[model samples]
Target: MFLLSLPFSLASAAELKFTNADESRAEFERSVKPFLTKHCVGCHGAKEPEGELDLTTLDPDMKSSTSGARWATLVEKLTKGEMPPEEKPRPDAAGLAATIDWAHAESKRANRNFTRRAAYENGNITPHSVLFDPKNIPPFDGESRVRRVSPEIYETFLKDAAKRPGTNQPFSPLGGTTFKDMGDPTIDEPVTATLFRNALIIVEGQTVHTVENGKIVKWNGARELQPLFDPQVAPTDAQLEAAITFQFKQILKRPPTDRELEKFVALLKRNMAEAGQVVGSRYALATVLMLTEAVFRMEVGSGQPDEKGRVRLAPREIAFAIGYALTDKGPDSQLLAAAATGGLGTDEGVTQQVRRLLDDAKTDKPRILRFFREYFGYDKASYVFKEANSGGGTIDFPGHDPGSLIADTDRLIEYILEQDRDVLRELLTTNKTFVAYRTAADWQKKLVEARKKFDAEKKANPEKYKNREFNPPVKMVCEAYGLSDFPEQQPVELPKDQRAGILTQPSWLVANSTTFDNHAIHRGKWIRERLLGNVVPDVPITVDAQLPNTPEKTLRERMAVTEQAYCWKCHQLMNDLAYPFEQFDHFGRYRAMDSVVDIEATAKLEGPRRNQTKRVMQDVPLNRSGLVAHVGDASLEGPVDGAVELMHKLAASERVEQVFVRHAFRYWLGRNESPGDAASLQAAHKAYQESGGSMKELLSALLTSESFLYRVPASPEPNAVPKAASKKANS
Candidate 1:
């Protein structure tokens, strides 16, 4: 009778249109309490609760209660019949339906209140506005600020400064995280601090010494500012001004305006009055000009917007942009000449410069190598920690170091670019690889020669060779005699069929692995996000994501837990994509078994060993079946058996080609693409397809696009009242 009366009371409350907090609380007390007492209180009551839920203490007001989410979860469990455990008493059909309806209504109210509070706190309905949406994006607002020189460009600039005609200071490279300089706009305090610290070091003559041949050698390089200040040749006032002008041109990449020249000259004169002329000039160049934004940042033109809401970049700005896009240094003589003649302001002029820069051997190799290094991220191999004692240590085979692996990858990229035929496809499917150590016989011969030379030197001069650095020769001996140490740098050719493309390289494999094991998820995520242009959502906060560590079972077998219904929702997208890499171990060596006996065990027993842990080989079947989905192109989406097969499919994919072009756009533009950038992207893609996938042609198209050449100013807000209208209304 009581249960039947509850629905009637709820109906009456509903008819009364109860909306306020007090009224809603009253309704919940009358209709919801009876249901919870009868069906849920046994397991979820005050004394002892199930799943950390206590229903009796829960507040009737869902919006104000912290337990509102728990109520919603309970409702879901009841709806799905996952609760009550099949043996416990279950609510009848009508009773269950009533409870579910009330829970859902309260949940919606709570969510609405939460969202409203968040919006109020943030001062907007959305915290962050999307910068780019394919359907709608505003025109480019030539609103770029003077950005600081990137780490790479700054290092090159410093090296060049040290090599100037009168300077004798050895350049000390600055080190810090360079993400901000590399187009990440987020302000980093560390990078800023590092720049300031390095500037001071360059200004003051600090003694920098190096240890050579067991003796400390002091380099007086920092004190020798002979190029900037020569005591033997005292300059007149006019000569000093000329010298300052030359420096401004070199450091800022442009001759200073009259006002800037006047300010700097005054600074130099004040310093000279206090100290000597040499000290004054050094202080002005190092501490003053070098720290200014003119030297640190690449500044474009700034002026009032024209009728079309557009502005053109200054000629000098265009020259700097073109030069930095192709090389780490400032503009060359030809580029500076073009800027002076105003020839860099047109599409045809820009194309000619781009062609010349691309063809120049000085610019081509390093730019292309750096581009691939950033794109593939295989350079991270130098930093990734790998365990030497584990089976994965096989990557240290005969004649390979992390550095050589990186260089080999760079060489392969250079080779492909030279071919200029379907470059992306070749990168994905090419099987040939360059290596420092190739055939067993050649490796042995080099090792023998190095060992013989070391033995002869040590025997011939016992006293002189004492405390000599013998590691290099010892490492060579190890490689020659089939010992443990990896060989040093020397190029050789690997068998063509042993590898296929960048994916199969040791550098990439080591980079994406943990110290003792492979992370298939990370590898798969990279391919999905980078190559396929698909996004994989982060793991849910509520989930404790971890795979079981079962030594007896293979990695694939242990990963079967992801096949469960709840976990499969997200894991299905990543696990299958990464499965193909199982053929290679964590250290990137191909193996039929999951673990292999340590081949360097004999070398360890012979003398002091690097890794002393015992190793055991284990046989396990590797599953290489993988699926590529959401490619839009149907032909490239399906199951694959191995890394080679996966690469073949990727090579044939149109989506892959588009993604490569998109990455190139981002790399050169130093920012993500916007809706306004669609025309530029399309032009580059068209160029790639038309020119038989030539990267040079694609770059030319991007540089000549309207998106790169012009910029529009931001529009005024709609709510803003015009000054003329306001005055007329007042009159």
Candidate 2:
């Protein structure tokens, strides 16, 4: 009879709405209590509350206890379609609608109550508003956001501390009861998905343990720690001292001594002073805790910008900065610690030391190439030029033949660093590649045979070959042909045609192009995005359907007929940049005929905002040479000469220098460039220009910046303290 009466009361209330807030609450408790007690109490009851949620007690009837808080939370979860989860029996459509309707009302009332209470406690709502505004969210300020390590940092940290490589088995940092209550029902936090993919971390052979109250109990044991996690074992006293010393040295950029060693030893002893189980285990646990997601990323300040308008890099970022600036071998904790402590100074002595260290010819190529890859979007070391007969991926060419170059690693480093040309300029426009002698020689022989056939054919038909330019013989063939006949291919001679810059270089040309035939749109997009700081929207794969098998068709032709009602918004810019590079085919080899088609290779490539296209040299009127010639004619400056000047201007620009510095700063510091950082960036930019854009100079400037040295970001207005005059007078 009571259950039947409850339905009558709810139906009556639904027909007539209550105007008072108290009436609404009364109506809710009366109508909803029966259903909640019967259906929800089993799992979300006061005792064995599932998901730490109890929907029965809520709002005015529920006080400040944790379980009472869970009611409001349960209301939200049910409304979001996230609870009564897939495993549970789903509510019928009518029931679901009623639950959702109640949840929204309850959430609104709860927020209103909170706001009133907060307003009463505080003089103003401004403070609360500052922290909880839904819109205009600030960038993540390295607080709770640094909840987990990135894969790269995790690997390095584990290897350094555990003397173990990261397992490929799946692993999660969360464990035990903490894992179960991961998503607090009373709050809006979501449970995270498990980590580990691609069989990256195997757990089959390991006996994972849970550390609770300083005891290392095996998993499924008596006591439950917060969550399942594999903590690092404690380092031996000597090892701890060694690691700390190494870190200090790296951060300070110098070695630590006896006094500094004593401090680290003292820290170890302090870990053992607390009351706990195994002393060593406790100490080990302390170290692990320090290295956990919470402490490992030590973001300081209230996440608000500090007085100097700068947010200091945390320990992890400091480590990254150190690793990026000093080595390509990857991050080392010891190196980071040293860099943090003024050990790595930018004084002349340290500079000389670094120069000598990097001078080793063996490691130099890899290091420089890594820097090139990071900054300029190219890395020769990892590049593959051809596919092997066995076939997995393409093959790479080492700088030297296997047995030909000197074996010393230092010698290799020296070779990469000792070149006299401007390093930046070389990155942009050098055709004199450092190819293996064997590969160079093999191509030479092939070219010689090709030239003989060409000459014979030309003699037979004078009209066809009389004025046409012949393909240059290969280097080895030219060596045999003597320098006079094929000067461009001869060994140890300046290239006659240094027309290609970084964009047109064989490696870059092949790297950016999707098809063997260059797509003007792709080329234009690349230039705009990578070179000119414009964002290009991605085209759909379906767009590729428009292409036909006509090998001789130009990129413009492909785009025009590729799609029905195809838009040319991006194509115009792309074609402009691409037509000039038509001289080079898909493989980045020069071509007269595209596949079997006669090259309609001639193009008049015009400069940006310019009147006409430049004509380059061309056998066929459509070739790249005619375009270059047309471009060249506009300036009367000639092609190679004009390119050289442009390269110099670009390398010397303040803007270009800053872009490099900003990029390095972003990578090393683990933070984006903030407006506050503009001054420091400019300082580094200035230093780079003054040092003739030496990469080393830029590093020195960055390390010296206040952003690098401080543990917290500086505030916007320095020396502008509130009540400053009063304080000064009182003092």
Q: Among these predicted structures, which one has the highest TM-score?
A: 1
Off by over 4 Å in 2: 1-166, 169-290, 293-307, 311-320, 328-368, 374-421, 437-501, 540-549, 559-566, 592-621, 625-658, 670-674, 706-731
- State, as a TM-score between 0 and 1, how close model 1 is to the true structure: 0.65
The C-alpha TM-scores of every prediction are 0.65, 0.45
lDDT of 2 by residue, 84-170 (tens): 555667555445445434433443433322211221121111111122233423322221223233333434333433322444312
Q: What is the C-alpha lDDT of each candidate?
A: 0.60, 0.40
> Model 2 misses residue 46 by how many Å?
65
For candidate 1, lDDT tens digit of each residue in 182-287? 3333235665555545554554443233446644454454433333354445556666567567667656666778887788777777877678755676667655
Candidate 1, which segments miss by more than 4 Å at Cα? 1-143, 163-181, 184-237, 274-279, 291-295, 299-308, 391-400, 437-446, 449-498, 538-545, 562-570, 593-615, 715-731
